[model samples]
Target: MAERSIQEVRAAQPSRDGDGVAIYRVAGMQHAAMDPVLMIDELRSEQREDFIGGFPPHPHRGMQTLTYMKHGGLIHEDNSGNRGEIRSGGAQWMSAGRGIIHSEMPTVDTRGLHGFQLWVNLPAADKMNEPDYRDIPAQEMVTLAAAAFDATVIAGNWTLDGESASGPLQTLAARAGVLDLQLQPGAAVTVEVAPGDSLLGYIYAGSMLHEQRELGPRQLLITSHGERWQLLAGAGGASLLLLRGEPLGEPVAQYGPFVMNTAAEIEQAIQDYQNGRFVPEARPLQ
Candidate 1:
């Protein structure tokens, strides 16, 4: 197996979204090689005012969203009549196949809101399929533990102690994996990624040494082609998220909440929303 090397390191840019919720955005449409993975936003704050407003009602199309909560909680409701709450250590996966209107609000009077929202693009073939939703509690997430490291496998598979653990999110058009990893001081781990897959690491706590370079909090590291990559935690240890996916290599036309292959498609999405074509009667999930 070949060793993967760090190709670039970029700082997460500060931005506000969803009714003024502050966040650190790591990647977006400008970075094409990151296809299938459109954006990653880290929202962390102990101040109640920072996330109180939450993400009010909004519409999305041609993509899927994965929200992982590390602390605090989020209440989600959509026009499809799906409603759920994601507490600390829980996650919500929503596929906005054709279109959907939804709102994600912070639990009332809750403090210490912290989590991440990742946007994954859909292939053209499945872009307009029926929307789907999944809420995964922390208890149901696969755990991989070693002497010095622990990880929550939200998507894809991981092998530890000679046994394999697979996440609940198995069906994705782009075929991707999401892992939340924590390493103790001086700990090291090597993860295998398939050839031709794009791999990214977002450091959120402490630091790590990758190929002689030190990556600290809020840094996004992109890796070069290889079968595996090694990560070593710094003295204070490290916490990070690992995302891997196959590139879609398709044209992306995005406008607000809609993402499509061309301007015409985006226009159609807008027209659909305006005509109430995407608004399904809100029926609470049974």
Candidate 2:
């Protein structure tokens, strides 16, 4: 087995989105190496001024999103006539297959939020499938408790030392493996990932050592090669979001919320929205 090394490291850049809500974002349009993953946003703040205006009703097409909150809440409503609340440790997975309109408004509180929204590109064949939505509570996701670390499996499967766990949403298009990982201070461990899957680690708390470089909060690590990761937690302990998925290797064209395979498709998406051609309603998840 070869050792996993860093293909690249990126720090989430401070940016504003959705009515000027502050966020640390790792953008995707510029990075070809982050195949299947189009974007990652880490939203963290307690002040009302930072997150008062949430994402209003918006249109989306041809992509999937997974929202995970470490601590916080969000009220979600979509054209499907469905509404739900996502509380601490809860997650929401939505795929705007053909098209859908939705809004996500945050719950205000002293604890605020420490959460992530990740986008996964879809294969061209499934781009126009029916939209899907899911809200999963913390208790529904699989949890792995180890001596040195604790992890929440959000999607796909995780196996270590002959023990295994699978996330609730197994049908994600990219076969994504999403994990919220926390390592005790100074603890070290090795993790095995699917061979050839594109991988990323977004650090949110404390720091982690990868070879000689120490990655702190707001930093992201991508795989250069190999299937195993050597991770060491800093003295203050560490927490990170681990994501891996098979690359689609397809051409990507995106305009705002719409993602497609070509510029023409992007333009068509815009026209469709304007023409009211987008799906007017969605079917509830069965």
lDDT of each: 0.86, 0.84
TM per candidate: 0.94, 0.94
lDDT for each residue of candidate 2 in 1-286, tens digit (9 for 90 to 100): 6767777898899998887788999987646668789999998998767777878888889999999988788878887666878988999999998888888888765258778999899899999998888999988988988898899999988765446888998977778879999999999767787777787889999998766777899989887667677778888899999888888889999999999999999998899888877775544322
Candidate 2, which segments miss by more than 4 Å at Cα? 108-111, 281-286
Task: Estimate the overall C-alpha local distance difference test score of candidate 2.
Answer: 0.84
Cα TM-score of candidate 1: 0.94
